[model samples]
Target: MRLNRRLFLGNGAAAATTLAAPALLAEGGGKPRVIVIGGGAGGATAARYIAKDSKGAIDVTLIEPSRAYYTCFFSNLYIGGFREMDDLGHTYGALAANHGINVVHDWAIGVDRDAKAVSLADGASLSYDKLILSPGIDFVDGAVEGWSLSAQNAMPHAFKGGSQTELLKAQIASMPEGGIFAMVAPPNPFRCPPGPYERISMVAHSLKQTNPTAKIIVADPKAKFSKMALFQEGWLEHYPGMIDWIGEDFGGANVSVDPDAMTITIDGETTKVNVCNVIPAQKAGHIAEMAGVTGGNWAPINAEDMSSKADPDIHVLGDAADQGDMPKSGFAANSQAKVCANAVRGALTGSRVFPPKFTNTCWSLIDTDDGVKVGATYEVRDGRIAKVDGFISAPGESADLRRATFEESEGWYAGIVADMFS
Candidate 1:
């Protein structure tokens, strides 16, 4: 659950030695050391796969602040009362003991690309022959007026899946019978394109059971979203009276919020709500930007290998990388991590790294038994992320298929967690 002094010092020394002697391979012992920052979907997978496939030829050290991770992919189920925190929470001991990944429970504060090292908040530095960063997104200050990290204690986003989630869950639990719960959906190119709507659906489902008179409002910046028609159909058929979705045309769009007032304005009209969940537009993790790995909102990587354009020795995946045509979802992050792992291995071992095919599937539950999905397969071509042939979801499918897909989503989550920390 935590990194010991021996492991930390050993990892740091291994990283330095590996970088210092790039061409040397010790007889029967020495292997290239890889230091990965952030043990979420992308970083965890990269650490596991590289350790598995490379045998003892690669040493992987994963740095993350938390020992357990709660996935956003299934946290909406928690809101729907279909699951619990323990059901979704995953630990890193298996990654350390079984997969040979040295897990560091610490935060990375600075990245020195020139020295090929990462500085920790604890005044230690981790050197790396190759660094993989999948720190995910950070909320942009001032993007939403009057809402910052401190104010999040009162108005929880629950987007990152930690204490914020618990706070939001408690707020929902203690709401008055007829109270209004409002959610402000972020703009495009954010993590999980269909996440906000799916969250609303789950919240409304819960409200229907606990407080029949409670109202759920969604103030969305976008006119349309992923699986728009299907979500609307499900809401109308299931929780029609409980949900109200306001689009841009109806003065529902806003770029900012007033946290102190607990009010949000759109088109010169301010509305107050008992609970507010505001998801701000996102960009690559701060470390990536510090290392000059990103453009405006995301890092540009060579899609063939998920190698950073700024520095080939470092690979950036997940929501941080600008994978064209790929929606920023946990599925995408997991898929890209495997591709990056293989590439990292090949880069270190002098093996042939082939062009990889990537895939993503995002499933959203509208209610307990009803769900919708979107998926695509992709391949790198001409240095860009491109969708491959035969990549589509079965829309307007049979009820049996939808139910089966929901079940399959659960399986996929388990498989992905295995592919990462298991």
Candidate 2:
């Protein structure tokens, strides 16, 4: 249950108690300090768990640029008119007031691993005994030819949620009658493996209502995708003729776009389009590389405790981690964070540290009241996270089952935000 803000902040007594308990330090030993960067699923949950479980034993500070975070997981539904932008937004006030975390809304510009200090964009440097990084993803440059960040406004990727999602929604709403919308899907090893396909479904859902004559074309570099069979089947049933997916076999991999002309070329054929969403290949967030933790595009981590293989004092989580078996979804991040928190607290305070076990579930909304899911449980095997069991929703399932799945996703979204913030 969530505590009411009024009661929790009554006469500001509880707030004052929390204010005096948190310390921002790393030098001497009043309390062991922990610094976390990127306050999304992994970073926020880790900070919350460390502080709450320690019961003020640890001084936890979360350094995040954005005070309000927009989740990228179900952002496709916002395009389909199932949710509002505000629905996906969360703030960090509860993590500070309720969990005794020091939430710093500032960018982490540099990390001095030798000194165990992080330099913020605001010119302040802080030290910590342990550093946790979950900075998510940054796209590879020129991964999608003829497209760049400068042209993102003209041909929106909308993959990272927030303003880009709003831009895509507005562009979709403004499309001329019988217009064309094209998506150049990113290659594998990106955030949310099933995301681009789901976006296609949601776009089709929106156009079916507002502009039934409009069309969606996908240029995918891979022959198959996550939940390919289920999405294909759902498209055939709900959106018969609106989608055309061009796989790599047909030169989908050979593609380019023109933001100025609003056109896309596939298989040497150029056609004008009303909107083009280009999701480029991705890499770990720049901060990870800057910290000398990432060996390549992603930071390798130990499955036992989600600690960076390069530096055990630094842990990587969420989309930025190259963990085996587990998909880089929000659920996976939260699970990894808990394991990491338990391990870190044990290292700092000699608490009981349980062996790490992880799980992740990805839910995609195909159409109204129609949802599909894929998930797995994982454990350490041979020093890597290995799948123990798995489950996925089968095609041709009953309407009742699909609706229940969608409802489950809604509950999860609510619960996760509360878990992260409250």
Candidate 3:
């Protein structure tokens, strides 16, 4: 905005090339157009930051499929009965009402990179000077044997929030006494490294109170998982004899499921389960791939700015971003969003850009008032977001510390929702 021509040359593109894009790519006086896709931890935060900081100097449009976003971060707690579904749902009304962001509720079906536009499910195309995609994740085709989207009703993934979470909770509540609950854990490089284990703990917490005799069987493709020792210790202390974890050593990866029969086969042994929660291998949402930004499963990004490695004018955030060492967590997504927001604002408005510093803490509830966490502070190192310092809850932390940890997660939930929407 400092110079008349600067608006057209956002991202320092040459004037000739910038004009080759869609006609909506702001000219001399037109405000730069920023289109953000998705409205969760990453996209919502990105849109809010860009809109608030730009202060009407930039046109920010947020496209999301849902009016009320359900966070996947605390969905496990919902399954554990610690929170109701309503507690996790947040509306975009606040974003539009307060920030002047054009919040459009629609699904992004495709992207026209040459034209610098996004195609919507409703047949509308939005032209963008800069595109921010944080569409979360999608399951890999046939990642789990005999498990597919059509079978989700019977074997609910419940990986994403909302109705699937509710369905999983209802299925758990309807589980007969002494019934077996099986979890088909995903392989490496999936969303939320500690998520499935936390869910197991939460499910155990629920079954202990309602059906103590119920058993949980976790079939994990990986040999070990995040905070394995801490979760195992907590399981022994709180819900002893409730969880049986079968890792790769025990053919846990050699699994298949029959949704109709409600049976899971692990290493040629088929067991009937009252509820089957399948967490399949994950990749960036299809829109990212459709945009030709994804390297493989995830969209690779520059650690310094969260800009796409493929396209400097495009950014990827949240679970979709391959930012090296950071795990796929709500906290990590929000951190990356701020860095991307700063970089994008600087590109479009010629604002002062700050050095990027990112931190992420993944907290999981082991039981009531019993929480454990693993976290790290990251910086640009070796051309990727690499850990500089970190911390994790120990195997035998004090009950007081664990309780405090649970309270901390609650506080974080409130702060993050406000950070994203309010």
Candidate 4:
């Protein structure tokens, strides 16, 4: 649906007076201003929904450095050489033209919560009646020795799905026929729990075709991973002898990588590899800390409204929020964005705000047609995210369901992008 500019302008004028005070809502008959930081899954959805639902009652501005976003969700397909960059990348033209969102191609350097303004790296300040922050995860430096941003040039993380992904793909292509490719999995509460394994599967798929003698070694800290059984079954059946997963017991817990030496140590044993993808521990994006909205690595928010515990006028969603029982995936972020949007509209318009129900589903492709998924419905109880019911793909499921899941995942991606940008 397209935005009704005239209707939005009129309603926004009235909303500004009620929410931001008559003086702040309009200096000379303007709409209520909203500044959203980060234009990924959560922020983009929040900005689009607020502008659409407000009908001109909210002037939405989105701050993001990239004009186009490369989704990490299905980026493995690109690594597998089955999809092009354009297939996974998305632009914000719809958000700008149809939704009337002011898309700012710049970074948010800081937030002055007391002043209700955000500072951009371009030396501009954006004043807002309400602010939304959905900056995704950031890798923790020093978590793995010799694995830093500078060293990533040699051992790419490929976690955020951009140039790093391409770099990792090139490394995979250059591996010797019998070379070893090692992956260092991160700790818990990180984005996309099944991501590392899926990456392994995709890379192994490519290796099996090009370098059949190559091996994939996953050095994981965790004993059990999401969809472990499904992933293992797929690996053994499809790419047998090529993929080897090492759990904590198998000298896999805790890693220290030396980029200079090009070696990774686990449990006092060192294994030099042709390529390494070390995904370090993650935390809320840097902006969350600059805004003083986070504790430790995550921001705590009221589950019902998604407003920060420290600042009620500011909301934090996506991987930045400490949403218990919710896997930090793009689907979860997109779902949370809608709930936050409804709450913001209710609060600003003096309408009734009901308790919210959050739902999420994450799909991972083990191969071109084989996929696995996990889903859950959540609610707020005792001021925390609590799961009500859900479904995970059963191990040893029929091949038909596995194939169908992959197709369904594509449809879900299309729908979510439309919901966010269109």
Candidate 2 lDDT over residue span 1-422, tens digit each: 22233432231222112222344333575788999999998999899988987788899999999978999988999999999999999999989999889999999999999999999999999998999999999988899889999999999989887999999999999999999999999988889888999999999999999999999999999999999999999999999999999999999999999899999999899989999999999999999999999987999999888889989899999999998988878988888888888888777877667768787889999999999999898999977889999999998999999988888788777767766788
Candidate 1 has an lDDT of 0.80
Give residue 195's error in model 3 in angstroms: 0.8
**Model 4 poorest 10 in a row by lDDT:** 8-17
Worst 10 residues of 3 by lDDT: 12-21
* lDDT by residue (tens digit), candidate 4, 1-422: 11233332232223222233222353345676788998888999889878877666778899999988988888988888777878878889999899788999999998998889899888999998789999998988787777898999899999896888889999999998799999999988799998998899899889988999998888888899999999999999989999878888887776788888879888788888999999998999999999998989899988887889999999999999986788899888887887788778666654444457787878888987898898899999877789999999998889898888887777777777666677
lDDT of each: 0.80, 0.88, 0.88, 0.84
**TM-score, each model?**
0.91, 0.93, 0.93, 0.92
Which candidate would rank higher by TM-score, 3 or 4? 3
Clashing pairs in 4: 8-55, 8-56, 12-56, 12-57
lDDT of 3 by residue, 35-138 (tens): 99999999999898888777777799999999899999999999998998999999999899899999999999999988899999999998999999999999
| Per-candidate total of colliding backbone pairs | 0, 0, 0, 4
Candidate 1 structure quality by residue, lDDT tens digits, 37-75: 988899998898788667657888999998788887788
